[model samples]
Target: MVMIHIPTHPLVHYPGDILAWIAASLAGWWQHRAFPRETERLAQVTPPGYYVALALGGVVGAWLAGSLNTVPSGLAPSHSIAGALAGAIVGVEGWKWLHGVRGSTGGAFVLPVAVGIMVGRWGCLFAGLADQTYGVPTDLPWGVDLGDGIPRHPVEIYESLSMALFLLAYVPARLRGRAWARDHGFHAFVIVYGAQRFLWEFLKPYPKLIGPFNLFHLICGGLIAYGFVWWRNGGVRADHGAQGSALSVSQPDDEPVRNLP
Candidate 1:
């Protein structure tokens, strides 16, 4: 069994997070231009306050759920992608309901968020056991020594690779004007993420809140359920199917969409 050695330090740990955010921002910019007209249309209906609500919800949920799982295990509190997703959903959906907005407004976020997670988990991998994202000890040939003598499952890489594969399939689907991708891409992302995360949690050493289930497993379950319901209600279009490829970013917008909200 070849063990992978990763040196641990604050610099090693935090830079991955910084890079992840930067990458996510770039991806968002690219995706925004990729579906310009759709962006405008969605924005016109989306509340300006939606972002604010999402931020608030994400922060609160990240802390609450992350700490809920980690602190009980006597580990330092941290944030969770799963919790952030849940928070963003509650915040955005609650805001949408208040403003009478309908349908999947999350289309724009699908790629960027997925990409963010892909990049962010690497930080956890290098952050060593302090990041609390490490998996249990494993004797597998590919196990990693994250500054700890015991080789453990490289779960962070597993998550990052999974999201990367998702982007490969998802990005093409939108460009090809696949209706399922356009309508339900975000929902599908949530479900896929939740399902994958749920499976991955089983390998982690986090204290289980339920019999054989950690806090994240429960959180992932909720996310999967939410994704299903939201997709059925919002992403399902009874009106029409794909006319053609959505407005391509390469083509100029008739008018630059500005301050839509």
Candidate 2:
């Protein structure tokens, strides 16, 4: 089997970071266009300080989670998207509770977040060994050499592709006005992301923390659980105030994912 040589260049790596954010912006804009009113409703009910909590939580979570794994592994400090996601949820949820706001407010984030992850992971892939996100050596046909001569699983690419594929399915289903997609898209994103990450962890060379699982495995497990709980708490089966009693949205079968505020 042929192995591909992946360039380990800061130039290659840093550009992906920019492109990822740009892609997220474009996706967010597109989604906003697709559902202007729902977007507006999400905006109106969203506390002005919500963004602040999300940003702070994300930054801290990324750093803290990455460091916890890398420092112990004798690698330089790093940051993780998974950690950032977890942290952002904690921050936003905490803020919402304090403000007495509830329901699935992350609907607006589904596309942007998925597209962002799909593009951002390419940065990690190009960063190579220095980035410390590479997987264990493998004899697989698609193995890549990221500066190292040894062929290994391209875990970063796997994650990026996973998100990309998810978007392909989600967008079409969402646009078709699927009830489940309208109501629980964010939770689905969370659970799928977590599940995929959990599987990929096994391919990584990170030190095992519990049995054969690593730190990320634990974090991913929590994420999966969180997604289900959040979905049940704010989903179609939700008892009341899925929108915190201030506002509630209902989708119309006649309209494609249309939810009037």
Q: Write the per-residue lDDT of candidate 1 for residues 1-261, one digit (tens) a residue.
A: 578887876567679989999999999999888888767776665556979999999999999999998777677888888999999989988986776555667778898899999999998888888888898989898899988688899999999999998888999988987866877788889999999999999999888778999899999999999878865655224335332112111123433222111
Candidate 2 residue lDDT tens string, 146-186: 88699999999899989988888889888987755767788
How much RMSD separates candidate 1 from the native structure? 5.6
For residue 23, what is the lDDT in candidate 1? 94
State every prediction's TM-score relative to the real structure. 0.89, 0.89
The residue ranges of model 1 lying beyond 4 angstroms of the native Cα positions read 235-261
TM-score of 1: 0.89
Q: Where does candidate 1 clash, by residue pair?
A: none
List RMSD in Å for every model shown: 5.6, 5.2
